[model samples]
Target: MVDKFPAEQQRIVKGLQDAVDRLNTIARGVAPIKVNKASEYFDLPEASPAAPGSGVRLYSGGGKFTVKTSANKTVTIPMADVANPANFTSPSTQTGDFASASAYTQLRADCARLHDTVRDLQNAMRAAGLMG
Candidate 1:
């Protein structure tokens, strides 16, 4: 085939064959380019606030993932806290003896316990960066 073509045409054919061979090699994963580093991954830009009834938009910025809903509500999740679950501590249990008191006293104690539980939950959420 080389002998059938002129010198210039033969060079062009060789170049084309070389290009095809390189593509085939890549397709077969013989010389694949690996993306092992975080920097090599594609980064998604922060999205604008979603329009009403348009659904939600999610993106990452300032070390947090922001999800903007069509209702104009934004929920920001800190990536650092999510990536490290071991850093989150369970809220301490609040104990009270509701059965040991009179009916009215017990009711008050129960309400106080419920309030304490709610406060503990809120504190836990704040500490875990789940709330402001």
Candidate 2:
């Protein structure tokens, strides 16, 4: 139990919890993706206040969704997933440097797996009629 931790450690944990809660709140308001004008059916973020000019833009003639970050990094999401947002595999990036190239690559793969898990959860929710 948290009660076993020293008072100082408990305070630190509480601080981290507060920080996570704040981040979650910010994530909730993130702008949705904007699909390219040429794309007949796709949705991507219009802007990401978090990434500033790195707002997501759609491309691939509605077959792909691309997002460019200020750091010149690009992320692509499948058009099918964009059309069915519930199935989108939202990627995550680790903040720190990796110990080796292999480590980095594995981490990236793990992140993809996490996204797949998210899609699975979404499917379960929809099957239960929890989502429309």
Candidate 3:
């Protein structure tokens, strides 16, 4: 093929082939990049609000995770409060005993309330993408 081409073209082809060979050799000697797990777990600086009309920003500090929206709205969650069942309590203010005539009726009412609370929690978890 080099003989069929003009001298200048043949020289250019040779140079290109040499460049490709050199690249292949360099690629073989290069190690594949690896992820550094330690670097991935670095602590973030103090939380700051995101600019309005820009985008949301996530921040972590003081043992809490904060998300600030472009509208300057922010929500923070404590890291220690995550996935702790004891931290999830019903906001219901049903302080008094069940208003039932019989003990059996009161027990049933209490059980129903408990079931509803659990269901609400599960729904919340699902909405947050923490539960399947």
Candidate 4:
């Protein structure tokens, strides 16, 4: 003959699941923090010259007590041929925000909770001799 769990035991299990679900529901609107996006590959003047088929050209650009011997022209410029670097600049901003460790932390927490709950259920079932 099969033994059944008491009603109180079933109620306890159900209540635990309900509470976990409620916690998840309440955390739905957590917006990630906005990260300040810095540009990589900033334009550096060739300081000498640009050869054909080369992206680096020797050009001069500096002024106002900064570059005393600044060259008058920019060389090997990347933007010289390409139109609109802005398109490549924006999406990287998610507004292209990378996933921060904090986000991973939240995800890790969720996964840990999920794992623990699943383990709890598995152990409970095993104890009750209901697991295969």
List TM-scores for all candidates, in order: 0.29, 0.25, 0.33, 0.27
* Model 2 lDDT on a 0 to 1 scale: 0.57
TM-score of 3: 0.33
Question: How far is 129's C-alpha from truth in model 4 (Å)?
Answer: 0.4
Alpha-carbon local distance difference test for all models: 0.63, 0.57, 0.63, 0.48
Better of 2 and 3 by lDDT: 3
Instruction: Specify the highest-TM-score model's number.
Output: 3
Clashes of each: 0, 5, 0, 11
Per-residue lDDT of candidate 3, residues 29-126 (tens digit): 99987655455576666856555577767776455676677877665643322332232233243445545345545556667766776777777666
Identify the candidate with maximal lDDT: 3
What is the RMSD of candidate 2? 27.5
* Preferred candidate (lDDT higher): 1 or 4: 1
Q: Could you tell me the lDDT of residue 104 within candidate 2?
A: 65
Candidate 2 per-residue C-alpha lDDT over 1-132 given as tens digits, one digit per residue, 9 for 90 to 100: 566667689789889999999999999999876644554754554543333365543334334445555665545543223122233232345445545576666666766776877787677656544465
13-89 per-residue lDDT for model 4 (tens digits): 99999999998888886766544554554444524333435333333444111121233323221212222212221
Residue clash pairs of candidate 2:
32-45, 33-44, 33-45, 34-44, 34-45
Residue 102 lDDT in candidate 3: 59
